[model samples]
Target: MAEQVKLFGVWGSPFVRRVEIALKMKGVEYEFIEEDLTNKSPLLLKYNPVHKKIPVLLHNGKPICESVVIIEYIDETWKGTPILPADPYDRAMARFWAKFIDEKCLPALWKACWSKDEEQEKAMEEACELLKTLEAQLKGNKFFGGDNIGLVDIVANFIGFWVEVLLEATGSTDLLTDEKFPMLCKWKHAYVNCPVIKENLPPKEKLLAFFRARQQPTSGPKYE
Candidate 1:
């Protein structure tokens, strides 16, 4: 019997988006259960007992938690288009950059937009430095893994799509200007315009509103 596949995820989460992109790329058919992180469903809790997070993949009644792990599992299970490179060293490099994006790049970018006044300035500086390091990694190709979208490309959606929306909603256009980070800017344009990625992305207007509400004074605590 074919294993039943299912995913639990929210609309605006980049982590969830990465899993969706991987599934789409591999042509995997799965049921999507939209999660409200504030009031998380019992199924989500039951599957991902450790993190209690979305983006959990259930295959044949067994659960796999975490976005990156899910992506790898989908790639290994489906066996269509490969997201990770076959060469060992290149594969290691991909994992390295993907980890860097998750660990170094994203936190800095969040602090850049979420912090206030002097802290925001400091965060922007830190983000700029971190982003430039990523830009350096993109010196030769249209993506982190050359022409094709891959693991690093999927995980770095924050820099490609979310950061622009964040800057607009936060009224910080100067944060990611073309001149300051030309390579990254060009890469962002390519990443956002890529047909598969563009199709899967949440609408810009909706994303703008979501971020705007979160930034407001009395918008309440963030769940995701």
Candidate 2:
């Protein structure tokens, strides 16, 4: 019997897009179920009750939650293109960078864009610091995984795409300009232009409008 695959995700979520990119890289077919996060569907809750989040991957009735975990699952379960590095140490490093992007860089960037006063200033500094670290890690490589995209590249999609959109929507201070982080900016262009990611990424104007709506005082900047 064929495997059944379904993805529960929202339109404007970087986390969800990363999973979709990974699936495309692996040539895996799936049903994309767009979710209204404010009013999540019962299936989403049933599959990911712990967080009640979108980007849940239901594969053959077994549900996997969290974007990074789901992408790892996609890599392990499918045999097409490799997502994670082959060497154990490289794989570990990729996973490490992925975690860093989520735990450190993304939070810092988000706060930098949405917060105000001292908090925003501090966040901007931290975000720049973290991005510089990533720039050095790039070490003049074409991509995080060398020539082709890999786990770290995929997981760092937020840095490549969402941060710019959020900053533009908020009309906030820009930290990702070419002058600040040239190598990273180049990497961003390359990563997003890759056929798989380009096809899967949401339209930038639409995403910007969605983010602009989120900035309303009533709605706040947090993604549901």
Candidate 3:
């Protein structure tokens, strides 16, 4: 009998999408179990006791937590489509940018989302610098790993989706404007339009609505 593969995730999470993309890339068949973060299940808690996060991949009852770690596991376990380069130097380069985005860019982007006006402006500036660095990095390559989609591409592409959504939700358009960061803008077009990515993306209208709702302040009954 074959080992059972299962994934616990939430639809709106980019981290969950990372695992989804990797599984799709590998042509791995797995059962996707959606979890409500507001009401997490015992299984999710058991699988990821430390972080208590979504996107736990269970293969033959062994759990793998964390999005990037899960992607690396998916790449190693499957032999059909290669997500990482076999060459040592290229693999190192891939890991370098993946680490860079996870460490530097993602946090800045999140800060920009939940910050106040002035703080948001500063966060946006930092995000632009990060995007500029990536724009320059991609000057001669189709993907971050060069010529083909790979690990860095999967991780880096998360920002592309959220950046646009953040720009729309926050009413700012400076991140990937043509005049400012042309390469990053072009990369967004290419990355999102790729067949695998395009098919797997969450709907834009729904995402915008979700963000908008999140931005609204909760109200209580007024007592005179």
Candidate 4:
């Protein structure tokens, strides 16, 4: 019998979506357990003691933490369709871009979304520079790993989705405007229109309402 697979995740989390995309790409069948970050489940804590974060993959009761790590594990375990390149150098390059987007671009975008006034401006500048760097990196490649949608493409695609949400919430479109980063704007179109992504993405208006609700100030700490 095939080993049972389970994924603990939250719908809104990009990291969780990364794992979900990888699983779908690999043609792996698994159970998805929706996690509430505000009130973390005991099962999630038991499975991922360290970070207690979502996107934890469980195979035959063993837990694997982190979205990227889970993606790699999914790729290695299943052979239906390879998400990483066969060549070592190409694989390394894919990992490099994935790491770059995770470490630098994601945080910069978050800062830009949450910061106020001058800080928001500075964050937006940093985000624009990061997008320029990514646009240059994709000069001749259709996806991050060239013609094929690979690991890096899966990881980076979230930027397009979430950044749009942040732009709406923060009332800024400077980072993804056509004038500054045309290539990235085009890439966003491709990423969103991709069949799997188009099907899985959260509804825009609902997401907007969700973010707006989170942005509102709470009255006080209360017992209900």
**Model 2 residue 199 distance off true place after TM-score fit, in angstroms:** 0.7
lDDT of 1 at 3: 70
Off by over 4 Å in 1: 215-224
- Per-residue lDDT tens digits for candidate 3, residues 1-224, read 99799999977778788888899988888999989877889999999999888789999999999888999999999988789999988888888888999888877776666566787789789987887787777867777767777898899866768667865875654566889877777777888898888877888888778777675322310100
Clashes of each: 0, 0, 0, 0
Per-residue lDDT, model 2, residue 161, is: 87
Give a tens-digit lDDT track for model 2, residues 201-224. 889999988878764343232442
**What's model 3's TM-score?**
0.91
Better of 1 and 4 by TM-score: 1
Q: Residue 9's C-alpha lDDT in candidate 4?
A: 87
Candidate 2: stretches off by over 4 Å: 216-224
| TM-score, structure 2 vs. true | 0.94
What digit string (tens of lDDT, one per residue) describes model 1 on residues 1-224?
87799989988888888998998899888899999887899999999888898789999999999888888888888888899998999989988999999889887887787778887789899999998889999877898889888999998998888888888888863777888988888888898888889888988999899988873433212423
Could you tell me every candidate's TM-score relative to the true structure?
Answer: 0.94, 0.94, 0.91, 0.92
The global C-alpha lDDT for each of the candidates, from Candidate 1 onward, is 0.84, 0.87, 0.80, 0.79
Least lDDT summed over 10 consecutive residues: which range in candidate 1? 215-224
Clash pairs, candidate 3, are none
